[model samples]
Each structure stands twice: as C-alpha cells, then as structure tokens.
Target: MARFLLIHGSAHGAWCYRELIPALTALGHQATAIDLPSHGDDPTPYQEATLSGYADRIVSELQAIGEEVILLGHSMGGYPISLAAERLPERVKHLVYLCAYVPKPGFSLNDRRREAEEQPLMEAIQLTEDGLGWTVGDDDLNRLFYHDCPPGTVDLAKAHLTIQAREPSTVSIETTARYAAIPRSYIRCINDGTIPPSYQVTMSEDWPSERVFSMDCGHSPFFADPTGLAGRLDQIARDIT
Candidate 1:
C-alpha cells in the first residue's frame, strides 16, 4: 500500500480533506493531510507565507514520515508540492495533481491563471487591502467551488476558510530534472467551476494519456464524491506499484 500526503489549496487547510483521508485509509492505504502555513489552524501570519516556506513545511512532513510517499496536491498546492519533490526527490514516490495546477518554468501560479482564456475565479476573489492575501467571496463560494458538493459543504467551508497568502502564487518556480524524473498523474474534474476542464486538458496536454484521468464532478470532489475519488486514487496507487 502507498502512503499518501495530501496538500490542500488556497485558503483551505487539511480540514478540507476530512472525508477523503478515511476513504483512502479504508482502501488499505495510509493517507495524511496538513495545514499549510496560515491556512486552517496554523498560526503563520498570511504576510509571512511564501511558496518556499510551504514547500519547506511539506519537506519536513516527508522527513518525519521517513519513507517514500505519494505526494498529492490540489489546486494551487501544485506549486509547493513540486518544489518539495524537487528538493527531496528520493522522499517522493509519485506526484499527483488533483484538479491542480501543474507549474511551468518561469511562470508563477498567478501567471498561469492569467494566461487562461476564461477567468472563472476573478469575480470571486476578495483581495485584502494590504495586497498580501485574498479570500473567496461568500456569494460565489458555493457556485465556484462546491456546486456539486454535499449540502453542508458550503457551511463547513465558510466556517474554516482562511485568507490565502498572495506571495506564494505570485512567485515563479523553476523546477529541475530532479522534479521532472518523478512519475506523475493528473486528475481533471470535468464539472469544475473554479478551473475550467478545458484548461485542465491544456495543462496536461503533453503528459501521456495513461497518466491523465477524469472525474465527472466539480472542484471540491473531496466533498462531492469522496468514494469515487478514493477509487481513482486506489487505482493510481496500484498502477504505480
């Protein structure tokens, strides 16, 4: 069985994966999630959260595990996971992008988002006055992230979402062959409202078809379809081993 380290996206913490972790554990795999910096219960101030710091946190977790594990990233989490893998390739067995961004050389996550043809999330973003962080507007929260999620998802998210640091997304990353050599897979959410499904296709276009999978759900599959997501992950784990 593969051990998995799941990373949440912007403004979200490990709490977001509440359902998926147990689902994966039930399938005979070990899964763990962590709050990245200022998100969730972590006390790091938003202004101090940087992409490298996020990667460092992930690296520390991997070291604590003391074994190779599959590193999975959701949405903006792609950036940090990629950096972690690059920093400690031996600690990572595989990289999985779940409706997540796949970083490009010299391009920050924000730069990539800007390059997208459709900006579904633009209107939903509420930037902080200090220009250091941003939060999702309540009115667009369900529509953009939890449209197909379970009934109580929005309420749970509303109670837990935190201000996402902007520096992490704005700073560009440069990955080397160490990162490129690791096996990777991408899961595209077909009904995604936050990140367009078509753009997901474009992002993973060069990847082998076998490494790419699809889910007929929105962005928050952890809430929308945990079992289905688990099944997909199980299959990926088996394939990897």
Candidate 2:
C-alpha cells in the first residue's frame, strides 16, 4: 500500500477531495487531502497566502505522515506539490499532475497562465473591494471550473467557493532539475474547458513520461467521475510501483 498526498486546486480545499479520499483508502492506500493555508480549515484568509506558504504546508504535512507517498496535485495545487516533490525527493514515489500546471525552472504560475491564453478569464475575475489578489465570478466558475458538473453540484460548489490568492498565481517557482529526474505522469481531462487539451499536451512534452492519460470528463473529474478517477489513480500507483 502506498501513501498518497492529494493536493487540491485553487478556490478549493480538502473538501474537494471528499469522495477521492475514501476511494483511495478503500483500495488499501493511505491518503490525506490538505486545505492550503487560508483556503480551507487553515482560516488564514485567502488574500494572505503565497506559493511558498502553500508548498511549506504540503511539506510539513508530508513530514508528519512519516511515509513515502505518491504526490498528486490538481490545478493550482500542482505548483506547490511539484515544489514539495522537488524539496523532498526521497519521500515521493511518483508525481501525478491531474489537469495541473507543470512548470519549468524559474517559471511562475502566472507565466503559464498567460501562456495558456487565459488572460480573458483572469481579467473577468473580480477581486475583493480591498484590492486583495483574489477574484471570482459565477460565469467564470460555470464555464471554466464546473462546465460538466451536475447543476446541483455546481450550485453547491459555487456557494462554497472562495477567492483564490493572486500571489501564488503570480509567483514564479524556482525549481532545480530534481523533479524532472523523478517519475512523473499527467492525467488530462479531455473536455476540460478550464485547462485546454492543447495546453496539456504542451506541458506533458516537457516530461520524460510522454504518456499523457486521458479522461472523458471535464476539469473536475473527481466530481464528474469519482469512480473512474479513483480507478485510474490506482492503476497509476501500480504502474509506477
């Protein structure tokens, strides 16, 4: 059995992995989903967080687990999880990017964001009145985030959605060749409006593992096809092991 650290995307917390955690546990693998500082239960306020803060939180939790783990990052969670794997290579068995960002050394998340040509969406996002670096809008959420999600689930997600910190998105990560040396995989959601398939292919090209797995769902496959997503994750663990 492998230990798995499941990191969630921006505007989401450990709450996003509710279905995934139990599924992984039932398969005999230990799993933990964390709420990045200020996003979930940490309660530090969304505007106050930075990429380093997120990465630090992941590393701290992994240390507490005291076991080697398969590191899984979704969306924005990819940034920190990638950095954590770079920081603690020994404890990471495999690095999985679930429709997540894959950055090069010294590349910030915003660099990839602009490269993905998502400036229109970014511009449409409305930040808090105090000028905090976070923004959200219903149209943006439905179109980019939960396009394929059930209406009811989408409503629930929107109701609970929090503004994402602009800092993490703007901060460029400083990575060594450490992560490239590790085993890596990408799970791409074919219908992901939030993250384009073309972009996924572009990002996957940088990795030695040319195998970019496909999912016939939207961006949030965890909600769209939890069973299938869990099954795919299990397969990856076996394949890497």
- Which one wins on lDDT? 1
For model 1, the run of ten residues with the poorest summed lDDT: 110-119
RMSD to the true structure for each prediction, in A, is 0.6, 1.8
TM-score attained by model 2: 0.92
Poorly placed runs, candidate 2 (over 4 Å): 117-120, 206-210
Clash list (residue pairs), candidate 2? 108-172
For residues 75-169, could you state the per-residue lDDT of candidate 1 as single tens digits?
Answer: 99999999999999999999999999999989999988887889999888899999899998899998999999888899999999999999999
Clashes of each: 0, 1
| Alpha carbon deviation, residue 130, candidate 1 (Å) | 0.9
Each candidate's lDDT (Cα)?
A: 0.95, 0.81
Top TM-score prediction, candidate number: 1
Candidate 1's TM-score reads 0.99
Question: Candidate 1, 78: how far from true, in Å?
Answer: 0.6
Candidate 2 local lDDT, residue 212: 64
